[model samples]
Target: MPGFSKILIANRGEIACRIQRTAQALGYRTVAVFSDADADALHVHMADEAVHIGPAPVQQSYLNIPAIIDAARRTGADAIHPGYGFLSENPGFALACQHAGITFIGPSPEAIELMGSKRLSKIAMIAAGVPCILGYQGAEQDDVTLTREAERIGYPLMIKASAGGGGRGMRLVHTASDLLAQIRTARSEALHGFGSDELILEQALIDPRHVEVQLFGDQHGNLIYLGERDCSIQRRHQKVIEEAPCPVMTVELRQAMGEAALKAGRAVNYVGAGTVEFLLDARGQFYFLEMNTRLQVEHPVTELITGLDLVAWQLAVAEGQPLPLRQEQVQLNGHAMEVRLYAEDPARDFLPQTGRITAWEPATQSGVRIDHGLIEGQSISPFYDPLLGKLIAHGATREEARRKLLRAVQDSVLLGVQSNQRVLANLLDHPQFISGEFSTGFIPRNFADHSCLRPQVPSDAELAIAAALFYQASAQVHPASLAGWRNNASVPLHYRLGLEDQAWSVELNAMPGEVYRIQIASRSLELKIIECDGHWATLVIDGVRTRHAYRLEAGQLCLFTRPGSLRLTDRTQALVSSQVSISSGTLKAPMDGAIVDVLVSEGSVVSKGQLLVVLEAMKMEHPLKSGIDGVLKRLQVRVGDQVKNRQILLEVE
Candidate 1:
């Protein structure tokens, strides 16, 4: 094998950092590339050398094939590693590197091209005699052809972009009426996301488990299957939780699936690390989904079970090394599970949030591994995926792994930028999840009420008691703090505090250390103060017997609790009126993006949830449907126009 002196990582975020660690450990210098937004990113700062590609927009920067090739040439890098995103599956980029005399550390360009298209990949799978979902793969651009195919295939089908993944250009149509509109919208999204609008229809399996096999191929034409990963726990087609050695797959099923994966790999002469995905139905019938021609986001689970560094193997194969070990030698170890920690609010429809990570701390223990991209004070921009890191837990058994993962989750202290940590913890403790009886619809089925996530506001009596305790604690720290005096006469101390939109004006009499007697409108409450540092305070209210933590930041009060917390904004500032309120009879765009489709006319009458407009943002099309059944009073946008968050898209009367 020809050893590489230096390797250039053609991606960013935790994946780049992950590759850098493995590459450097193998005695190779790593070159990292960054856009304007990632200048202070952890991955760029950790690289041996860094190069600026372009602006924050991915198209001009991360997706710029020529710029990446140029960076590799300038850095004297022998090989380029596309770390699972951006141009990772771009066959054109691979061929470009080949022509430039630089090693593309992945499968051959032909393999990538073959599997890149959903239509062609299905064709290949069928030709290989692999079981596949029944769907129409014929060319159908117009709505009429698509509608006919939808009827022929039956209802409850998935319209998927042949050139895209990550749930970007996919739509679920349950009825014939919604098929045409969904197809048009899906095509537009596919074009915007993958630069191609070609799509294929697939039978949407009910209660399907998303299972994938990890395959590795070497220069000697040897393809081996390491193991399998269960990534059925998903939201919007993006994997959230992944586990190794699928809990449902028996030994017999594993051998069958493994052999099928190897056949798929050899059929395309695939090399490097790749995943062959399949959907396993409730009846144990598995159907070939597609093959990702690069390392998967959830590769850590497979690594934990197999005790192998897939990245290292990729480098070895790229350097012309044959498989060092045979498939028979591979041992499946204990169970492992990983959860993706995203910088988005689960309560807010998982919208991408951007802000400074005020506090970023994750647990690192014997069985826990946290692969992260951001650090304290790092900014999360909207131009990229909201993923911050992946938390993986390994154990001797699946039950042990689940318990360890739950414990690590509780120990994590990720603050600022609303995260799905609580949601993950909730899922970990779910009865179905714990018993391994969950499917793709687990989250939806469990969290249908939504009330569990949104905590009710604390009662006024509770807040007054908490405030009195806080005043006493302050007075104990400073003798004259909570008590106002004139001519040695004691008076009530006036203070302002808040709790989740409810404000309070407290009056207290200071006593000794960490004690105070307070009154709130004919009610007397005892106080006990625990600790205070800067704007944060811990105090216990009399009769409540519970210690509560509070923090004052930017004239707002934040209270932290176990199940949830409260965010109180001071009403001193001018209150900005909501842009769209059904009460005001207005409909607004939910995001900042372009108007990809105008589904309603000026004088058209529509019902609630009837598609009125489709706004594309972050490569996903958000259908802005009518909030209420009424006349389309006004259509404020056209087919092609830039819109901002909360911009009124239309009005209904």
Candidate 2:
């Protein structure tokens, strides 16, 4: 049979680039679709042909089925590949592709509709003899009915959106008092995210391990399971780290779970790639969680261990092919691990960060692979998922893979935006992770120290080197007889710098031939510049040599080293202090987002730590609370207002 000659990827970011790479290797032309915000994005340039879809927001672009199909038709593409997130699992998109006579590179629309609803999928799982958690999946969604169902299921249950994944529209309620509010929030989020307000309830298992089995099927009814992946390392109910071949899995358990996963697949005549998730408890028993009907974000680890290209398999199956390998022929070798690098601050509750990437350097090694969609000057907007890319490492043993990944992360460089690099490094070194004895509570129970997330302060020697570099750069511009030679020779030239809410004062005396004697907080050191460039500098401090990547942007000095990156402001010329506090009664937006709802009104008395507003950014809802007990004196924002960073939204007095 003839395969597809041209394929169009209907997604953005790293996943889009990933699919194009495979399609190009298979001798197929590739087409890319992008929003206005992503006009110059990396994926757009990597494709054989590019088309503009719509504006920045997803509803106007990626989620617009008509725009995507029109782009494919204009480019003369014969197939469409929905790479994960946006409309990958939407049955409507699949059915529309079929109507347009375009081959959808995934399972049939029937399978998507059957497994898209968590409530319906659970019912099907039960019929297929798969174990499921005790819960309610009724149709009545009124407040009173949900409240009564919560009481029947008892406290500490889960409310999950029936139509979406990625932890969106999901909440854990610990008591009856908070049930109604949570249900409303979950329903609103579900409607906004998935266009469906339907939900299902499940018993919240304590500290359960998240394991999922990978399955693939073909048009000829050949289906097979490809082991499992452990995805329990999470924060805010989203996976942070993942690995293939669960650490605690034995041959017996693997076989049983594999069979159960196959049963679920066969139940829907599942075709293409899919994952069956389960919640593994302490007693070694597993219960069905949900099924993902598209390619997963962590598919790299599975591919690394199994020596297979999942995207290639996806394309072949879309062309009416049979399974390339039987169950007995499938083999799992070596170990692979992956970490998701996000554009967010790990120190301040992982708040999403938006800025321009000044520098981008990815790790390159034999066993390491970097899948990213970033340019040197790309802007990370708060309009989509915060995932920048993923880093994967493979080795013969799990320990080897862990060590290799640590080294790779250290060698990589990503400046300008705050990332989870430090947090990921610390987690890999933690005792629990190293020993492979941890649960879902690992982050909250063991890794609560926010100090690890903060950037380390420069040492006295490093400070002297920075002073020398700054003075040298200044002297070259003025061409003075002697750098910083003042009428009053006894006092040295003083400079001030600010770094992450802290200020430092430096006193420096310039010497001959680009040298300086500097003092910071009673510590003195001598420094000499070995080589000087505006972007990078090499210096010798008290006979110790070091080099650092540097950038000066808008009076802010950024230094990048192997340990980490730090940003400092030149505070010498400021008339007032740079660190200005918000007015006593003002509440400012933490980041750029749309105000979802305001929980309090003016003149209402609220206690400390009361939820005042809910802001939606980067596709997640964050609640802002009152820091002090006070009356809501003024409301500056409404339910549907768009806000910027540090924009005042309300006031309390």
Best by TM-score: 2
User: Candidate 1: misplaced stretches above 4 Å?
Assistant: 452-511, 515-531, 534-552, 557-566, 571-582, 585-617, 623-653
User: Residue 390 of candidate 2: its Cα lDDT?
Assistant: 94
Give each model's whole-structure lDDT: 0.80, 0.87
Candidate 2 per-residue lDDT, tens place, 256-375, comes to 999999999999999999999999999899999998999999999999999999999999999998989999999999999999999888777889988888888887987999999999
lDDT accuracy of residue 188 in candidate 2: 89
Work out the TM-score per prediction.
Answer: 0.86, 0.94
TM-score of candidate 1 to 2 decimals: 0.86
Weakest 10 consecutive residues, lDDT, candidate 1? 481-490
What tens digits encode model 1's per-residue C-alpha lDDT throughout 1-653?
A: 56678899999999999999999999999999999989989889889998999987798999998999999989899899999889999999999999998999999999999999999989988889888899988766677777788888898999999998999789999998888888887887788889999999988897799999999998788989988999999888899899998999898999989888987887899888889999998988899999999999999988898889989999999999998889889999999999988876565577665666765557778998888887877877767877888989999999988888887876676655667777888888888899998788877778766554554455544555445544434445665642453122166566555543345565666555656566766777766656666334556566555544455455444454443344554443335444434445588765566787897788888888787787665555667767788888887889878777678888888
